[model samples]
Target: MSPVSSFLWTYAVGVKVLLSQLLSRSFSLPVFPLQNGKVAIVTGGAKGIGYETAKHLSRLGMHVIIAGNHENQGELSVSRIVKETGNEKVEFMYLELASMQSIQQFVQHFKAKNLLLHVLVNNGYIRWPVNQCSPGAAAVMLVPQRNTADGFEEHFGVNYLGHFMLTHLLLDTLKQSGSHDLNSRIVTVSSATHYIGELNLNDLQSRHNYSPHGAYAQSKLALVLFSYQLQQRLAAEGSHVTSNVVDPGVVNTDLYKHTSWLFKLCKWLTSWLLFKTSTQGASTVIYAAVSPDLEGAGGSYYVNGQKVKSADISYDEDLQRKLWAQSCNLVGNPERHQCAS
Candidate 1:
């Protein structure tokens, strides 16, 4: 997208978020009922909306694992949330989403504990500027390096594919944990930018032409597609698990730390008016996980604590299946049955 278009689209999204915040003034999700034995894994949960979501779940007596690559940040976040919520079950686990091997290790590590998982928040994300290296270091920062440790583009690799691999590996645990009353929840964080994304499945890696904006948008769109498809398969098999996607609205977070100085200045000046706080951004995610009304809800897009329609293209069954097959191939054939069955 052109700079003008990016700005306009961003502005429009900001306006919409602001309107929702104003109209819902004084609105807040009630404290979820205590969930003593439930377990949740929140990827990228070291900070921002992910951190807030973990903290909320912790306060409600759920065991919350904050998964991410940075050991120090992850540990510190665990300490802080545990301290604040007085929930001793909160802890940090290492999971690098940019590496499929790392994701596999994470699931293995979790399974070792012999615990059941009630919620999996695929919330870890890399910002848009992996291509932007420090001044005079552009040579080593070529586009291929922009691809993840695996060969996929970083946005798709970390943001979408890594989570895809994690979900498939853990689906059995999620199925076993869910019950007739409380379905297991798979929540993938997405964005409104997905609506403008033009996916070129023909060039999923953006090898011919690459743009950070387009790549990020495509990754998010792919996430929603995966989520909807996962729900469909689960429902067909008479499983108790549910999968859904969420757009947290524009929020002030580290996700914006890589943008240009001018963009940062504008955000700093207007964030209080236009942006959702990380806690507010996490509301819908927590709702999807524990809300009684949403126990069996699946294949839905959530915004601001409510269900809504996603882009029309996201509803395409053929497209969802095609992407799922391709993603399975990308991740490897060994794990296909985890999602397919």
Candidate 2:
């Protein structure tokens, strides 16, 4: 093995073992019943934990809209959910999580339906580096740097900003379904990596220096902060929408398929040693969505079906407000709109 590879394996093996142990004993999963006539929107519901969550929710009888980047995968997931749950209400919508324009288009399409949004799962993410353009898209000079069409770092743009904008656009429908008062939920799928993150408000985009893990952590932390901020704002304004965040723990999913050879080896070891099945990984998300414990709770972070303390930095109100303002501008939703009376 290469020197670096050997070193990573040596160090990561013990860490993985410990993670597995802690996760297994931390908390037990909860069960929830779905209210009939409710509707849910799950972004990235085509595969992995997102697919599992959508399936479970569909089984509970909610009309589900599976929003994802890959059209084929989305259709497949919808078909699978329908077959498994025997609910023909499950459907798919194409959403390119990397593009703000695509997010807007998605909202416009949903608006045409004029249905209330009972739950919104902000679950899609991108984890690997990309070249500036497709090798065949154009013959122009290639830029090696990474960025999204919205000009933000790719991880933050897709994982946080796209969902941020989508939620903003659908605020009215969400309010209509219910909120804290009637059990409406906005579940942000955060990560345990947030323990290693500190939101540098001055460098939210990570312009000067970037680490994929670092950027991912920052985005997840932002999601937590945004959830809390939204909860507080809604309560203060007497709106019913409740927001919460959850970590799925380490799961054996396709997310790591893009890792380098060295990293892939480490991922394999980690999966064998520490990872939970995708169903277990998605437990916390489902818990937040339909658990009776969460009936009236708003702005909380949960893991393994229990409330947990978020990193101290995730509680920065000043940064939360700034991030909220930045998100509104980025998403082009200046004022949050309520349902027409």
Candidate 3:
């Protein structure tokens, strides 16, 4: 982890993303059939790649619900998409991914509407800087280690657990929509950083050895593991619901807003050269969600609209099952039959 090594690693990742984008440009996405009555939900849909994703789905005639914590941004995203797509079905719903209560409330509200959910895209994310300071303070300090309302590490809680709970709560609705047409999909946004992540089952919350980058990697690795497990469960039950993970290659998004100034400067210097636009970053997500070519595919990892091999560790069945059980326990649903052996 020397400075030079870090810079090299960053450069390599940037190159990989740029290559994926270039390769992706040669392919065209298949036109999804009319989705006039289908319902889709995109978390973190207020801005960046998520907003672009919401816009794409809305253009296909699906009723899209943009879920996020910011009321103003969420409403504005909805307005923009509606205006741009001329699809009035676009709307916004409040969601706070760090709070278990908020997730439950949002699910309840959606269920009360009696809507069948055809797509659930877990795209929200949070990344803490390597350092920070309290409001109005002149002194800077290492970012304090924190946990979510549910007592899990902040990154793991919001990035993986919250989405886990949301998906679990909406399982029935997703199944309902898939039962007839086999088009229901659950898309989880993951990252290439998962390759460097190691699952510490003993310290699931990173109580002892917590670094910002390590924690973020662990969260994304957990997401990929969850996606695979979910697909297995759906197939085991003979359900039509498909679950897949996507790597939206190196997008210039708000996920980096809290990084150090040095990091920001480096990124700004290379922005145009290395970073993918939000639209490009969102293309893989859109592909995973509605691609007719992936009609029956599950437990697959996709990048730039193509199936790619994930890190070797990501394919370990024991690790995937262990994470699945641990996540269910953390979410307070240990007795749920879906998680039973």
Candidate 4:
């Protein structure tokens, strides 16, 4: 899209989000009993909504692993959470979503601990700028494309594919840890932008006509489809595991670090009336993670603390299967039984 078109499109989306934020009241998460001994892995837990979710889970007495690429930040966040929550079980683990090798090592390290896995929160993401230009500048100066360590589109790879591989690698442990009464859960962080997503199955890597907006949306939409598809498989197999997607309302976080100057200006002017804080945005994640109310419920798309329908295309069963199969090939799911470095 041209710079003018991109600006208009972004403005429209931003307006819609701000209007929704104004209309919707804060959702109060229902308090749940302490989840003693249960384990959870929250990717990108060192900051923003992920950090808040990890801290909340830790407060509930659950063993929380803050998985990310930044070792220093991860360790410090873990220490902070431990100190604040008084939960020594809170710790950090190295997991670089951009690299499958790092993901494998993360899983191996977790498995070596022989701990039970109750929740997996796929919450990390990066938003590259789409070259927001001035009125006097060219209308269509394409931002240089970004790729992951595996050569996939940056957004598609780190945000969606990384979590897909991680979930599959840990699926067995999640199943074994869950029971009929208290089912295991997988909560993926999706976005309202998913409604605008357009996925080209043939070009899952976004090798052509790449735009950060489209790439990010496509990745989030993929997560919704993956979550629903995984939910279906878990139910069909009678596994005591559930998979769900959560659209944390547009929260004030570094997720928007790549926004254009104008957008950032709007944010500063609004002073958070137009956006939810990270703590507020994490409500649905915590709700989906441990709420007994959601036990046994799978494939639910949660927003504003209520279950809602996702994008119309997300329900395409055939598309879901195709994406799943393609993702498996991309992530080497066929070799999941044995750890491959």
Higher-scoring candidate on lDDT, 1 or 3:
1
Q: Determine which window of 10 residues in candidate 3 has minimal summed lDDT.
A: 133-142
lDDT of 4 by residue, 25-136 (tens): 9889887999998999998888889999999999999999988766667788899999999999988988877789988999999999999999999985432222432212
Q: Which stretches of candidate 4 lie over 4 Å from their true place?
A: 1-7, 126-144, 334-341
Give the best candidate by TM-score.
4
Candidate 3, TM-score vs. the true structure? 0.89
Candidate 2 lDDT tens digits, 37-154: 8899988787778888889889889889998666665787798899899999998987876788888889999989878888999874532223432112110011123677888777
Which candidate gets the maximum lDDT versus the true structure?
Answer: 4
Clashing pairs in 2: 179-240, 180-240
Q: lDDT tens digits, residues 1-341, model 3?
A: 33344344544655676666555563346677877888999998878778898999999999999987767667878989999999999888888777888888999999999999999999854322224321121111113468776787877888888899888888888988886446699999988877766688998887875666666667888899889888888898888799999998878776665456766786788777667888878888988888777887889998877899997888888999999888888888833876653
Task: Give model 4 RMSD, 1 decimal.
Answer: 5.4
Clashing pairs in 1: none
Q: In candidate 3, residue 93 scores what lDDT?
A: 89
Model 2, position 267, has a per-residue lDDT of: 64
Residue runs of model 2 more than 4 Å from their true location after superposition: 1-23, 26-28, 126-145, 179-181, 258-263, 334-341
Among all windows of 10 consecutive residues in model 4, the one with the lowest summed lDDT is: 133-142
lDDT of 1 at 166: 89
By TM-score, the better pick of 1 and 4 is: 4
lDDT of each: 0.79, 0.72, 0.78, 0.82
Q: Flag the better candidate by TM-score, 3 or 4.
A: 4
Clashes of each: 0, 2, 0, 0
